[model samples]
Target: MDCDLICNFKKCRKRLNANAWVSIRKDIFCDDDGSREFNKSTTCPACQTSLSGTYDIIRVDLQQSEKYKTMVLAGQKPETVIDIASRALAFWTYQITQERTYQEFVTNKGKERNIQMEQYYEQILARTAAELTALKTQLAATKKELESVKKKYTEATEQILDKGRQYQKLQMLYDALRRKCITPLTFDMGDAPVHMPNRNPSNFDLTLSTRDSILRRENNVSVSTTVPRSPAEREFLLTPGPTPLPPTISDECPAAQSRFHLHIETPNRAMSRPH
Candidate 1:
């Protein structure tokens, strides 16, 4: 049969050091030496009863025992167990504290760096915005100026074109006037009559000649005189024919003629004219 027991022993040496019968019984019967028998008789150390079945053994170590003793001793105000164990615990505690401190410092520094970077980025964005605004303003002004210049240029070009056209028109008029002024005049007249000087007379005589008489007269050399006859005969023979009038006269007319005659003649001759 199997016997089961539940017991807590601090250490193997602690059980040995108790020196009590009960403690020895607990160590010898419940520890490594304990056993359960079903067909044979296994008696209890104190009561001399058969051991129970299905017993369990529990073991402990010196380190845990010493640790508990030190805890207890420290509570009881003893300094004997204050050794490497306490030092190790203190070292672990200090390490954890230092780690927390470093972590906090690193976190604060990261936050500060992030804040500085944000500020720098904000400044850069502001400067870029200002520059962009300035550029846009300049571009607008330039565009306006370009439009003004283009308008002026168009006006000037139109003015130049107009002047050029006017100059061409004036030049054509001048050329036409010059051609008219420089052209020479030509006259043509057929044979008509020749007048004798000082031929004006109220009456004169004339003779009619036939073709036979003209032939006889051509053969003869004789001077003949005629008597004064009728007015018709005189007018037909010796009357001064009407002087031909000038076909065209200048608009300046009398003044221009007078001046021309004055220049051509002597002063006495010009003064002798009728007023």
Candidate 2:
């Protein structure tokens, strides 16, 4: 009936006899029934560590000592071989337990690291996507601005071309005026005639007078029969039929009546002249 109990602590495998075992208890109150019950735990006496039901103790029977000695025959007795085997068994069990715990610790640490790496990569991808979206918006805005600028430039260019064409037309008109290529038309003044004799063609001067002015200044009439420098001053006489002229009247003067005669200047003689 003699037996040895091994401590469950892998690092502290203290052995105990059957006499060292004790029952630890606590009384708990159940609120539903208002009843009391005893809660029990079996613990190691030397280490004071709580032991699970399956790992509480390792028991070795002293009755099997003779068989262990026959298997390990080195002049060793039965009790010595049993003692060596019990310690060896406890040691190998501790080694296996410690190895399993270390492997679990390593596995949990690797799982945490993988979770952290995955979160970091997700954050980077999200940031990259946001930046790409912003760049696309900016690119679209820039393209629209470029199109607007192009439209404005096109309108301004068309306006400039139109102004250039207008300037060309004005330049042509100015050239025609300078060359005197265009002629003005002529018109008749009245039935009365004035005289201007012994006058130089360069110094000849003419004035526009109404019918009343010519009739009032009959004797002192000064008419100039000078050609116009440019035809812009004359008005055109566009009639449907030929105009008839009155007969020339004879008047005697002391100055030069016999020398030269002044007559009414008609539009026919003016139009018949060469340019």
Candidate 3:
């Protein structure tokens, strides 16, 4: 029911079994079966051109039309030059389409990445500006607070110095008063005996000494007239010490107290003795 057909075109002249030929009757190309109905058309496999009535159709034994059988019997058949060219053109077209698609994908992806990077940079700049503004505000507040603290410190320092000056003035006045109180008293017992006939007698020599000297009456005799040398000594001059009480004044009269108060209790001996 099938035949072998060859293209009549001298430039092509490719041969193929009827089953492998194009069929115009059904508008379907080659099929696996070799059911060759009459009036079926075919094209040259190399040129893809119709060779319908122009080609010769030779009746072929079914067993001989089998491709594997033909190959085994005839070894290998070489493809026509046009067939090789056709395949090369098809492969080239496919490669071109695939390359164009890949290029489009890469270009679109690059554009999207660039847009995202620009947006990210803008966001970063905005955040930085806000943080910078906040820092400036904080710095200004800190400066204000520092100035306030400095003012308070200056006022406090001035007050402390003023109080210290007042304390020093008071201390100097107290020392002056104590010095005046200790000024020795002078007496003139002209041509009279310095001694008195009594159970207790006056210890004063009745002789004139230095005007600024101190006079301490002890055992009815004049004692030392030493004066304070330093401000510390003057301050401590009135402080009571662990010295023995005068026998004549056992009730006790501290030197510092007597100097500052201007009041000294007369010794018991002086009070009891007759003048």
The number of the candidate with the highest lDDT is 3
Tens-place lDDT digits, model 2, residues 140-179: 9999999999999999999999999867766665654444
Against the true structure, whose TM-score is highest? 2
lDDT of 3 by residue, 106-138 (tens): 899999999999899999999999999999999
lDDT of each: 0.48, 0.49, 0.50
Q: For candidate 2, give the lDDT of residue 241.
A: 68
Q: 2 or 3, which is superior by TM-score?
A: 2
TM-score, one value per model: 0.38, 0.39, 0.36
Candidate 1 segments exceeding 4 Å error? 1-86, 185-275
> Which regions of candidate 2 fall more than 4 Å away from where they truly are?
1-73, 77-83, 181-208, 211-275
Descending-TM-score candidate ranking: 2, 1, 3
- lDDT per residue for candidate 1 within 96-119, as digits (tens), equals 564466558989999999999999
Error of 3 at 234 (Å): 21
